[model samples]
Target: MAATLPQDIKLHTKSRTLELIYSDQEQFELTAEYLRVHSPSAEVRGHGIGNGVLQTGKQLVGIKGLEPAGNYALKIIFDDGHDSGLYTWEYLYDLCQEQENYWNRYLKALADAGETRHGNMIAKG
Candidate 1:
């Protein structure tokens, strides 16, 4: 079974990042660009499997605000004016736990697909 989110969740926003503190004392500091491009919304993640979109031009983005969505999720607002994507507790936890691996995989995928995260040039597969 999935673990339930802690009752106390605190978010500390910096100039270009967000620090998430869980009740268990686990902490994760994520950049706004990472969070923005990796959003779980349909626009980014798509509605079903194998429909993900490539998010580009988010290398220097920052969080504009954080809004609570009941007790299960948070609506993260970005400095680029994106305010969708409700990040559930489980998803957030997974993101934190798998941060390093996910980031590496993302970078590799970008290279393999010849797609740059900053939209510079398309790579040939």
Candidate 2:
């Protein structure tokens, strides 16, 4: 079977979510934080296997824009100055399908590392 591509894409800046609509009436809403932490870029994914870096403090990340990469993928420009990862159609679809599982795993990893999604915040009085 061929890979499923979205029929329409909506970037909701206010909500910081990317909505993918399919012809079958299916839709998936992915947050910027989720996409940022799961980026396929070498910076996030690492140079090779088992060296991936954990993205922290991305709870407030937002999508700046989306650019199509040829006919196979999307180049997502994030508000945090990250623009390296190319989210292929297949990968995006997989993310949509396994969002819950992936999110749970990410949360678990963060907990294991004693990290917080809020990253390092400096309180001002």
Candidate 3:
């Protein structure tokens, strides 16, 4: 059975982002770019783990629309033409709680892979 979601849901909008709060006291400030890159949709995360595509050049992306998916999730449409991630309440809470650690790890992974998130570096011939 699925876990019960929080009773109260709140959303706050910033200049280019949205913050979601749950009744369980968990919160997430989802930047447009972060949401776009980390979308749970097959297009972004792929069919399974380790199949996620690296998304770059979306530092300024923002949310263009939001739709409710019953009581368990939300559908987010981004300005960059991505709109398939169904963000569950629990999953979103986890993302908020783990954003800092996840972001740091992502940065480290990019470095280890000799990659730049901005896509400005060029390979030498």
Candidate 4:
């Protein structure tokens, strides 16, 4: 089967979310914190099985910028200085489909590891 492509991509920095539209009329809005921690980079995913890193403290992270990685994926730069992940159309779709499950798992892992989301948002003081 052939892969589906995204018809449009919009990064709303103010809302810190990525909006993707596909030719099939499917749309998704993903948050920057979710994308950052779930990045498929070696830094997070590692080079082999069981090498994935546990990311913490990204509750308030925001997208700094986004670049197209050829015609297949998006290169997202997070405000926390992470810019290695390539978000492909298929992957993004999967994320949208399983967002709730993934988020629950992330939260559980953080709790099990005695960690917390150290978001980048500053307190209005």
Clashes of each: 1, 0, 0, 1
Task: Please report how far candidate 2 places residue 83 from its true position, in Å.
Answer: 0.6
State the lDDT of candidate 1 residue by residue for 1-125, as single tens digits. 13646445444455577776664567678777678878999999898999998777677666767888997788998767778899988887788889988888778877787877674422221
Question: What is the per-residue lDDT of model 4 for residues 1-125, given as tens digits with 9 covering 90 to 100?
Answer: 13456667889988889987775557888898888889989999999999999998787788888898997788998887789889886787788879999989998999999998884456221
Stretches off by above 4 angstroms in model 4 are: 1-3, 23-25, 119-125
After TM-score superposition, the amount by which residue 29's alpha carbon in candidate 1 deviates from its true location, in angstroms, is 0.5
Q: Mind giving the per-residue lDDT tens digits that candidate 2 earns over 1-125?
A: 24478989999998989999976668999998999999989999999899999999988888889999999999999988899999999999999999999999999999999998995533221
For model 1, name the residue pairs that clash: 114-123
Judged by whole-model lDDT over C-alpha atoms, candidate 2 comes out at 0.90
Clashing pairs in 4: 57-118
Candidate 1 Cα misplacement greater than 4 A, ranges? 1-14, 23-25, 119-125
Q: How far is 47's C-alpha from truth in model 3 (Å)?
A: 1.9
How many steric clashes does model 1 contain?
Answer: 1
The CA lDDT at 116 in model 1 is 70
Give residue 103's error in model 2 in angstroms.
Answer: 0.3
TM-score of each: 0.80, 0.92, 0.75, 0.86
Candidate 4: RMSD to truth = 2.7
> How good is model 4 by TM-score?
0.86
lDDT of 3 by residue, 1-125 (tens): 14335444444334556776553555556676666667888997778879887776666666777888997798887766788889987777677778888777767776777766664423221
